[model samples]
Target: MNISHLENQTFNPSTFLLTGFLGLEYAHRWISLPFCFIYMTVILGNCTILHVIRTDSSLHEPMYYFLAMLALTDLGLCLTTLPTVLGIFWFDAREIPFSACFTQLFFIHSLSLVESSVLLSMAFDRFVAICNPLRYGSILTTQRIVTMALAFAFRSFSLIVPLPLLLRRFHYCRTNVLSHSYCLHLEIMKLACSDIIVNHIYGLTVVAFTVGIDSLLIFLSYVFILKTVLSIASREERLKAFNTCVSHICAVLLFYVPMIGLSLIHRFGERAPHIVHILMSYVYLLAPPLMNPVVYSIKTKQIRQRILKKLCAVKLIQT
Candidate 1:
C-alpha cells in the first residue's frame, strides 16, 4: 500500500491468459459467428455515423457534432477489444503479454469514461436547445465544443494514467488467467497476491466520482429538459422539444443499463455462475457501441435520411 513498497520485489508474469466463457470452450467457434457479425456491424454503423456527420453540412450543429464524438469513443472501444475478443474465439489466442494486457486495460477504462462523458455532453446539448433555443447557437460554438472534448479526454486520460503504474507494483503469485476475453482492471487485479486494498479503493473512488456522478448529471439534465419542454406554450412545441431527446435518452440507456447490470451482478451475485460474469461483460462492452448508432440513425431524421440515401445508391450500383 505504501509507495515505498515499490522497493519490494514481486513475481510478474510474462503474460496473462485471457479466457472466454468458463465452460463454453467447446462452443467458442460457434459463438464467434454472432460476435463476428456484431463487431462488423459496430464498425460499419459507427463509421457511417461519423462519415455522414462529417460530409453533410446540415449536421454541423452541436448535437450531431457530439454524436460524432460518441461514435469515435465507440470505435475506440471496438479497436481496444476487437483483437483479443476475436482472437480468443477464432484462433484460440488467449495469451496476452503483461504489458499489452495493461495497455488494453487502460484504453478499456479510459474509453468507458469518455463514453459516459459524451453521453452527459449530449444531454447538456439537449438541455440548452430545449430551454433556450434562441441562445443555443451563441452558447455551444465550435470552439466551445472542441474545448469540452479536450477537457473530458484529458480528464479520462489523467484519471486512468495512475492505474497501470499502480498495478505494476502488485504481485501476482497465482494463476494469471483472466475471467473474460479481454483484459479488465477488475479481472486482472483479482489475481494479485499482495494487498490490493489501495487499488480497489482508488478504482471505486474514480468510478463513483467520474462515471457514477456523470450518470446522475445526465439524469438531472434531462429532468430540467423535461421541465422546460412542459412549460412551453404550444403542444407542438412540447412534442418537438421532447422528440429531440428521444435519441439521446436511448443512447444513455444503451450505455448505462448493461453497465449497471454488470456492476450489480458483481456486487450481489457472488454465487452467480461463471458464464454470467462473462456474458455480462460482453454485453456491457459490445451492446452500447453496436446499438447507439442504430438507435440514433433510426431516431434522428437527418441521420436516417442520409444513411438511407447512401444505402439506396449502393444497392442500385450492385444491381
Candidate 2:
C-alpha cells in the first residue's frame, strides 16, 4: 500500500489495468453476455428513435429535436464505456494506455453532462408547451433549438477538458489497477502520488455547476408545469396535459436517482461491499440508455403508432 517509494523510481506506467469484476473473475465471460445484450439494446433502441424522428415529418417540432439530441448523447455515453467493459470481461484485455484512459474518462463524463443539459432543455420545452401553448412554437424556434444544442455541446466539452489535462500532470506512482471496467475521474484521481486537493475541488465544482444546477432547474420547470396543468378548467384536459409529461418525468428519474445514489455510495459508503459499487455503477450507466427509448415508445402515441406501422409493413413484405 505504500506508494511513496515509487516516487523516486524512474519507471512510470504507460498503461493501467481494468479489473472488470473483482470477485467474479471466474464468471467474467458469462457476465459479459448480459452486458453485450445491454449494449446492443442501447445502440439499436437509440438508433431506431433517431430514425423515427428523422423520417416522420409530424415529429419535427422542438420537443422531438431535443429528444433526438438525448438519443445521440445516450448513444455516446453507452459507447464510451462498452468496448473497455466488454474487453475486460470477455477477453481479459485490461491494459489501457494512459492517454486512452483519459480519453474514455473525458467522453464518459462529458456526454453525461450533455445528457443532463438535454433533460433540462426538454423540461423547458414542456414548461412552455403547457404553460404558454399559444407561444410555444414562437418561443422554441428551429434556430433557437440549434443554438441550445451548440451551447450544450460547448458547455460540456469546455468544462470536462480540464479534468483530463489536470490528471495528466500528476504521476500515478500507486497501483494502476482500476476497480471498475472503465476509467472514472475520482477513481483515477485516487491513484495519484501528488496532492489532489485541487482536482477534487474542481471535480466537485464542475458537478455542482453542471448537473447540480441542471437538476434544480428541471425541478423548478416541472413545478411551473404542474401549476399550469392544474389551472385547466376541465378534468380531462388536466389529465391529458399531465400525461404528456409522464415519459420525461420517468426518464429524468431514471437518470438522476441512480446517479445520486452512486455519488452517495462513493462519498459515504466507506466499508460497503464491492458488489454494491459495481451494481450502482451499472445502474447509473446502463439504465437510462436502455429505458429512455422504451419509455418514450410506450408513452408517446405518435412514436408508438409509427413503430407499429413500420413493423407491420416489414411483416407484410416478408409474407
Candidate 3:
C-alpha cells in the first residue's frame, strides 16, 4: 500500500546474530567458499540419493521411501535460505524486503515441520518392521506411504500458513534488520513495535503441539522398539535391532539437539556468542540434510551398495 513509507521506516541491521563466527570481521567472505562447497555437495548428494531410491525397484521399501521424503524436505530447506544467504555474502544486497523476509521465515519453518513429521513416520515404520516383522509388508503398504506423506504435507501447511498471515497483521516498526542470517520468526518478532502477545502465544503453542507432541511419539516408538529388541533374548538379535536404528537415532539427535539449543538461546540466552547462534542454526538445519544420506547409506547396507553400484555403473558408462 505505502511502499516508500515502509522502506524509509525500516533500519537495515548492519550486524546479524551470527556475526561472531570464524572471524567476525570477514566471516561472510571467509565462510563463503567452504559453505558453498558443502552446500553444493549436500544438494547433489541428496538428489542422487533420491534418484537412486526412486528409480531402483529393489530399493522401494517403506524405509527408503521415507528417506526420499527426507531428501525432498532437506532440499526445500536449503532452497529457502541459499539464494538470500549466498547473495548477502557474495553481493552487496544484504537487506531483504519485508514481504520476502516473512516468506523465507514461513517456508523455513514449514519445511522444518514437514521434516519432523517424516522422521516420525520413519520411526513408526521401523517399529512395525522390528516388532511385527510378519505384518510389516501389510502395515506399510503403498497407499499408507502416500497417506503418511500427504498427512505430513497437510500438517505442515495447516500449521505454518497461519503464522505468516498472522505476522502480517503486526506492524514491524522497531527495526527491520533481523539478527540472524535469515529471517527467523522469533528473531524478526523481536523487532515488532506492536504488542506481540499473539505472535509469542501462537509460536509457543505450535512448538508444543508439533515438536513437543511429535517428539513424545517418537520416544514412545523407540521405547517399544527397545522393549521388543530386549525380548528377543539373543545378544545377536539385540545388536541387530540396535544397529538398524543407529542411523535414525543419529539423525534424530542431530536435528533435535540444535533445535532445542536454538529455542533455549532464543528464549533465555540471547546474549550467547553470535557465531554459536549462527552455527547452531546451520547445524540444526543444514546438517540434517547433509547427514541423512550418509547415515542411511551407512546403516542400510542395501541402499549403500545400490549407491555404490550406481556410481560404478556411471563410471563404466563414461569409460
**What Cα-based lDDT does every candidate model obtain?**
0.88, 0.90, 0.80
Candidate 3 local lDDT, residue 148: 84
Q: lDDT tens string, model 3, 1-319?
A: 1323334554554322222233343566776787798789789989988888989999889988998998999889888888876775676355666678778888999999998898899899889999999999999999999998998899888888877787777776555655456778888777667888888999999989998898999999999999999899889989988998998888788788889988898899877866677777777778888888788878888888988998899999999
Give the distance in Å from residue 312's predicted Cα in candidate 3 to where it truly belongs.
Answer: 1.3
Give the local distance difference test score of model 3. 0.80
Better of 1 and 2 by TM-score: 2
Give candidate 1 misplaced runs (Cα > 4 Å).
1-12, 316-319
The superposed Cα distance between candidate 2 and the true structure at residue 114, in angstroms, equals: 0.2
The 10-residue segment of model 2 with minimum total lDDT is: 1-10
Task: Report the Cα lDDT for residue 178, model 3.
Answer: 51
TM-scores, all candidates, are 0.94, 0.95, 0.92
State candidate 2's TM-score: 0.95
lDDT of 1 by residue, 282-308 (tens): 999999999999999989999999999
Q: Cα lDDT for residue 12, model 2?
A: 45
In candidate 3, position 228 carries an lDDT of 93
Number of clashing residue pairs, candidate 3: 1
**In terms of lDDT, which candidate is stronger, 1 or 3?**
1
Candidate 1 has which clashing residue pairs, if any? none
lDDT of candidate 1 at residue 190, scale 0 to 100? 75
